[model samples]
Target chain A: MDFAPTPEQQALREKVVRFARDHLGARAAEHDRDATFDESGWKACADFGVLGWPIKKEYGGGGLDPLTAIMAYEALGEGCVDNGLVFAINNHLFACAVYIADHGTEEQRRRWLPALCDGSLVGAHALSEPETGSDMLSLTTTAVRDGDGYVLNGTKKFISNGPRADLFVVFARTGGDDVAPQRALSAFVVPADTPGLTARDIPKAGLRGTLMGEITFDGCVLGEDQRLGAEGAGYQLFTSTMEWERGFMFASQVGVMSRLTDRCAAYAARRRQFGRPIGSFQSVSHRIADMRVRLELARLMLYKVGWLRSRGRLAMQEASMLKLYVSEGLKTTALDAMQIHGARGYTEELGIEREVRDVLAGTIYGGTSDIQRSIIAGLMGLPTAA
Target chain B: MTDDIAKTVRSFIGEHVQDGEPGDDHDIFATGSVSSLFAVQLVMWVERTFGIAVHPTDLDIENFRTVNHVVRFVESRRAAAAPA
Candidate 1:
């Protein structure tokens, strides 16, 4: 198999890098300090065609293939230092807008995709309630049939982009027996302005620039057209979207790892102790080496996932494997960078500490590390209860 | 074709499931014959063995609850895929 990127892919990466360096993540420290969402940075990404990179061009998107999109996201992470903003864009594209594009009817796509592609509507995924984090099948959210629509009632906690989203793809139980839990759920594309829907920002230790929050839907009414796919298809919809979320969403994190490696290597070479550069010492050099190793491994797995998706193949196993590797690998690399930089790394101004904090949440979100492990094992013909 | 599909499905069930001699119409989920993970495995097997891609809308338990059901589901999918 050919491992080299085409000229077009390379050009796209270069263009994204240049654009991100010039336009995105300006004053990231201030946004992180205040735990605020950077609307300007988001608008810049939307304008740069990042929000619709994988969507069809007819819907006001770039319609790039899966591999090209991964390259662009990797370049975005390498060029733009704002991890939170990148994450917000990923959540919006993969978790929310993808539902409409992949599962929505022609009318639904016509209604939502253009607005979502442009900055007219921000998107968020409504899953992971306070009680059900990884236990998605047991979600207590209820959507009962009304006259011609459905009324949704539930609380979705730790939702990325919750505070600023204009549209939310909500997963709620519709029908099925307790024994057959997988068939009980359904997906809906609900507007955030629905009468009974409330979004409140929850301040967190990291990824603060992307507003995370709890959204309470109190008898929120949605029309019949809002339903994605068929009734009792929410779990399937979620499982299908998860390959993107778990695999391609972490493409940016791979870029972050590469950046951290470069930064740490430069710092080690520049910083001298006992009349010689710290690179002279094996301890410091070994950490740098490990950082490089993790970056390479993460990139390989991530690109493999992209290649698989580009071919319209099922990558459930690879996606789970990549999700577990990249997130945990980034955390380790970030910690290594912190230790190599010493005091400067711990300081807020250098942003090494922020990187550590930001990457720490990677293992927890987009399905936890534990959940990824379970998924990997289960896919391997090993029976698991999860 | 039905017999072949049923044999393939039964072998998968026997490999993962234990402590029960389930009938052809047994509720695989309710009877604890298979967990959700096995359900996914079964889907993958059906797709690979029969060369039929099961859409997300067709992932209902009614189609996968038993070996007999799986055979019927595969036959229907093949029929649908065939030209008039």
Candidate 2:
């Protein structure tokens, strides 16, 4: 119920904002143009301990609590101009890092988590295939068991952090019946150097710095130990992680909403027409006000998810709701921020266009806004759209 | 020392992460290890598991640099937050 940030949390916010201003701003435009992945910037984040904030100390993590981490991430999102860079970092942490910390065997954790925490490795999630965008249950990727290993054959499309990832958490069908379709799925952690594994960049409509691509696993062989959880648990694993994604991934978008709202308000105050700041007009002022309303609502939901999850509650619907709200809110905010800015917003030269592009994917990826609504409606036992 | 907090952190990871080594640093986010949405959950977990407030300054990759860092920080925070 109470939303005030604690003192410690405030300090972290200041530092992260400063870091974003120093490193991610200005150059955000450069990265957008060159499609640069800011290797130096990524490492600096590592040095600053951005990579492992939520990880446990044993595995080289910062060990901050859930709500605090969310607050910090929101702060990062507020100040960081490069949503792509921040997006990449989110994809890296939640998609790859959490997978290992949760499921890896003792020996596996010993071998991998340190490097991941230290920034020695870049991780990627290889689940989406060329043929399947939302129907994961119907995915065609196959990981057939061989002696001591599995032979994986399939291609994953639009995978974030693909271009430079050294390790991958790949999902493939092991065995399943059509009636209960997800039964055959399994997850695996495969190193990038494996002979049959290849990834190529795939350009996107926005969030350009995320380094997405099409990754083909051509008879890629991995040891039996590489399988994540028990065989045929992929469906279960994926379902559970989605709740995590829906909740955590969208945290930053809340910050984006705030950022857009603040900027729009500032612009409305300064830019003038008809001898008065445009903000004096109901049309402009109302849009900025609506933007503020959406940001606060989104933050409330995000925090609730965090709180419920920390209490060992099933937050599937809450997460879906938060994801759906924040992602959509961000799109609206970006559009408005752009509208208020006019030409500067439309021009690629100003980075506003890129933000609009970047936020559009929020609706599609991490499960589309439509999917989240469906899930939420289903959970609430409400009739959904046919 | 109760592995209580450590256990809590581990369980949070277990419930959400795909199966793999429990401690592989490289395997966390890089390998589709966790969802991008876990930042909030991770923060909440830190607060609950260690019984301390996670300052914003310590929220980035540094405080989360390693699992050990997480465990220690929590212990320290809980200790500091405790009344003498």
Candidate 3:
């Protein structure tokens, strides 16, 4: 149960902090206001080897282990004020790239990994549709067998990086109504240049730098070689990938929570209130203290999931708990910062209001707070379902 | 072994699963009583109760469509794991 960071992890954290502070999120407010994806920051991240942190060296990646990757991401979150940039990186690496690296065949890995690592390609996961969010089996996306390939027809909504992604990890139904819906699903890797694919930007209030969009696949044909895993294996692949998504994806948000707390506490101390510092007030100080507690516990939970992953053990329950905790914790802390900073927080100048907007998406993505609660309860042998 | 596996699976189903009936092999997925979330729990239960791990390849809905299928999957895994 050691909580101390290794020397290498400490150094990596420092390096990431330095890089992120110097190179990323310079015009975060401008980008967020315009709902624009920061291409320059992304290129900087690629140059810094951020995209390849968890991938293997053979695949043109840094090959960092799960724990080290989490540490580096935490540093990035702390140093980079652009939550949207971090969210984009998270979506690319965990949600899309890792899918191929973990489940793709050797041929598939060789085909896309180098480009993915070098930032020549951007990746997006196409799972959610107009009709589905968490109910994956109910998705109406279909891939019909045609000769030696499949033709896909579907519309994926609320996709991160969709507008600019060069590649997509798409989940669609391949089996007929006779098969169970869960068993009917299959995943495919589709390039954006495919003849029948279109991605339209869907402007949103937060995570604007990630470029949320809707992807439409109309008779988009992919060869049999592009299918990930075997037929009817999409459910398993998605569930396992979600283990990574729910566990490691939010480690950066834990870092964001820590950063927000420090900012709030400093504001509470330095800002003059009725007589002296606002920190002298019990209500304000108590909220700051609560944020500290949440940060500590959230870090512990995040690290526990990383540790479990490192040991090749199952972390289904822990991942759901961590995802739920860190997400909600960040939201609470962000709102607290807003309240503590008063008008300054509410104003866009201080970026405190932006933090609130950014943190609100946490409880909704990956899996909703309600969905996580259901997962936790179901794991506890309760009859809960999401 | 089969009886024990069935009993354990039945016990879990009766306790945690909504609208589950004992001594029946009704298609849980077809009925919508077993959701993806419940399916994960069911897999974990099979692993813990049978002392065998359910690999990703073993996660096909066919393996968990019914208690009878689960018992068979567990038996096959246990058999494969046993010493020659």
Candidate 4:
């Protein structure tokens, strides 16, 4: 029942917020405009240990507990103005590095985690493909067993950090059609320099600084040691790990919601119209009020998921709800901020427009809002198309 | 104790299976009796109902492919957890 953070947690959150505000997002506008990753900000975050907040200290990470890590990331989202950079960091940490930490054998962890924590390498997940978006079981990627190795061949599209990632946690079919669909695939940690691997940049409307790309794996050879979990366990591994991807990754979106709400409130209090502050108008104030409500509720859901995970409990249903609520909440909050700001929000000068574009993808990635709704229904014991 | 566990597991699985009730050894996944998500739900349900933790190493599908398997898993976990 204790909702308040411990003193140590509070201190860590404050430190992260301060570090993010001071060191990150300096070139947000330039990077957003040019559609490029912010290498300097990435390095600054690495130097500040922002890259390893949740990883174990034995592996060169800060080793904050799960709930504390969520709190720190929320602060990072609130303080860092560059949504794209935060997105890139989330993909690297939650999607890629945490997978190894959670499912990798001890030797695998020893081999990969220190470099990931030290920022000597970047990480990305490869699941989505040209023909597969939500239907992961239908993925066409194949990894055929070779002598003491596997030859992987597939194309993954819309991969965040793909262009610059040094490591990829890939999911591909290792079992034939006759295998049970649930056990037809396997997970692998493939280095970007694997001989047959290549990446091509795919520009997008927002979060442009993250550098989404298509990765082609053509006869890529991987040692048996590169496998993450047991063979034919990819589907199970993905379902189990999705709590991280769906819950922790969107902690930043909750932060973005708070950031947008505060900014809008400030603007409404000062900006005048009809001989009075915009906050005097019920329409303007109500929108800001709704934004605040969503922020509070999203934070509560996010914390519940964090609490469950830190205790080694299942959070699949709660994570789905958090993902659905926070992604949709941030999108609406950003749009409301735009409407409240009127001309300033619509234009490039105030960056509200960029916020709008950045949040537009939240509902699409990490499973679409529609897909989340289906997951929630499925968990409810109701029949679902999924 | 084993009968009670089997009965409870059967009831839970029965709610999710579309067609007629499955035999103790039916492969629910292979028969499409339940979606893949049911695997996650069944694991969580077993933990909550039987008061035992299912660790990462226990994630193999063989541990949960049928009522017989689930019963065996629950018994093994409970036995391991019992006082010597």
Candidate 5:
């Protein structure tokens, strides 16, 4: 029943917020305008140990517990204005590094985690293909077994941090038609420098600083040791690990919601219209109030998922609900902030427009809000069409 | 105890499978009797029903391929969790 953070957790959150505000996102406008990655911000976060908050210390990480990590990341989102850079960091940590930490062998962890934590290497996840969006089981990527290795061939699109990533966690089918669909695929940790592997940037409307890319693996050879978990266990690994991707990744979005709410409230209190502050008007005041409500509910859901995960418990259903609520909540809060700010929000001056564009993709990535709804229904024992 | 565990698992599987109740050794996955999502649901159900934690290392399909396998997994987990 206790909702308050421990003193250590509170201290870590304050430290992360301070570090983020001081060192990161200084050139958010320039980066957003040119569609460039925030190199300085990335390096600063690495130097500050933002990259390894949840990883085990034995593997060169800070090793903060799950709930504590969520609290710190929420602070990062609240203080950092460059949403794209935070998105990139989340992908690196949750999607790629956490995959290895959770499922990799001891040797793999010893080999990969230090570099990822120290910022010498970047990480990305390659799952969605040009043809496959929500239907992961239908992805056409294939990895055929060779002597002591496998030859992988596939194309992954919309990969965050892909252009600069030194490593990728790729999923491809290793089982044949005879294999059950649930056990048809396998995951591999593929180095970016492998022969026949190439990546090209794919620019988009938002989160431009993250450098989304399309990576193609053409007859790339991988040792059997590169496999994550067991053969034919990729689907299971993905389903189990999705709690992190779907739940923890959105901790920052809830932070964004709180940030937007506070920003709108501040603007309404100061901005004058019709001889009074905008906050005096019921329409403007009500929108800010609604934004606050969404922020509160989203944080509560995020914390519940964190708590469940911190105890090594199943959180698939709760994660889906959190993903659906926070993504949609942040998007509406951003748009409402835009409306409240009127001209300033619509233009590039206040960065509200970028916030709008950034939050727009939250509902699409990490499984769409529609897909999340279906997952929630499926978990509730209701018949779903998968 | 094993019989009770198997019966409970069979009942759960029967609710999802279209073809009548499967035998103890029937491979539900190979028979295509349930959707892929059921694999996840089945894992969660086992944990909740048996009051055991299914760790990441235990995500192998072999462990829950049939009623017999699930019964074994539950029994093994319970045994491991027992005062030792």
Candidate 6:
């Protein structure tokens, strides 16, 4: 069967590739070293509609189809060299913006989405507390109701976009005291300027350019109107958004995988060793070949997921498979990228190592590789051992 | 689902599951009894046939591990969604 991208998709890819090259590629190394989110560069992405590609045009988004949006995002990864900025944008879009789109009431969408779309208001998801990352069901965060408002109290760790998030999609327990948390959780849209909310920058080994931080809500007050869905539907909201995030966020990495291979190939061909290009070596050529295999294979899976999502099909299984495959593929590909370039790949000046470090997190965040496997196995109806 | 419908659902998994032991206790997802993609399809089939929306919280190995477990879960959901 023909798998060629359509002419329109090709044009979209070309345009995003050009934009990313012009804005993010040249400055990738600088931003990597700064350990700060590229505010100016991010706004540039917004202007290019990268921030809102998946969202509807009514909300000031590009209103692109799922497959087309991901294809464009993959192209952005190919052109842009800053993985951190890409991640920050992905978090803003898939995790934060999507929640409002799928579940928010009309007034909520009207008030929050336009600014979020245009990049006026940065967004972040604050669910990973120090005590709870994957175990969201057991999180201690509470939004106890008092009159028409809820008072929030909790702390979230390793939050991407925490420092700059103008709006937060926060999760808190709100069920009756005797009720189990499955029906007790609720989600809200809390402004960053809320009196009791505070965020502190978290230092890290990589992707530091996207400010990760610890977010604390000490009795922060929010109106009932701030609730995105029914009080008990917070868990459902988070789960749905998470499914999208796990499914679509890896689109950029597929693009990044292409970039890794290209970078390695160019270096292998031009960089002389033993009076010949390093790529001529069997070992080096094989690594690059393996990298190529991963790129195409992972791309196919991601495309299937993107298509399924576009069709409004329930893609729980496809998303898990794609997430598991692509995240691991990126790490392995980046590792080979480092190996192919030798010291050049490892050096911070080239920003290649930073990409590897960024890829390292793909398996950890958005649920760990272990977690993906569990989901995959669970979906397979297989036991834990399998 | 009625007893006959429940038996039909069980038989579908029982017959198709590669496990092939054809017992009531066959583990579907974990045993390679069926493909993971089938679980999604089965979930949809259960939802459409019974008109019950399975909550995400209900999606776990505990309830979905075996064919019997799945049928029982579907029955419970059908009962829960039954009109008063």
TM-score of chain A of each: 0.98, 0.96, 0.98, 0.99, 0.99, 0.97
Can you tell me which runs of candidate 2 are displaced by over 4 Å?
A176-179, A382-386, B1-84
Alpha-carbon RMSD to native, per candidate: 2.7, 10.9, 2.7, 1.7, 1.4, 6.5
The global Cα lDDT (0 to 1) of model 3 is 0.87
Q: What is the TM-score of each candidate against the true structure?
A: 0.93, 0.80, 0.92, 0.96, 0.97, 0.85
Write one digit per residue (lDDT tens) for candidate 1, span B43-75.
777888889876645656678878789889999
Task: Kindly list the interface RMSD, in angstroms, of each predicted candidate in the order they appear.
Answer: 3.1, 12.7, 2.7, 2.2, 1.7, 9.4
- Using TM-score as the measure, name the better of candidate 2 and candidate 6: 6
DockQ of each: 0.38, 0.03, 0.38, 0.45, 0.57, 0.10
| lDDT for position A49 in model 3 | 96
- Give Cα-based local distance difference scores for all models: 0.87, 0.78, 0.87, 0.91, 0.91, 0.81
Candidate 4, residues A303-341, lDDT tens digits: the string is 999998888777888999999999998988999999999
Task: Write model 5 residue lDDT over A27-142, tens digit each, in one string.
Answer: 99888888898888999999999999999999999998899999989999998999999999999999999999999999999999999998888999999999998999898999
lDDT of 1 at A167: 94
How is the predicted docking of candidate 6 categorized under the CAPRI scheme? Answer: incorrect
For candidate 6, the share of real interface contacts preserved is 0.07
| Collision pairs in model 5 | none
Error of 4 at B31 (Å): 4.4
Poorly placed runs, candidate 1 (over 4 Å): A176-179, B17-33, B46-84
Model 2, chain B only, scores a TM-score of 0.70
Docking class of 3: acceptable
- Docking quality of model 1: it rates as acceptable
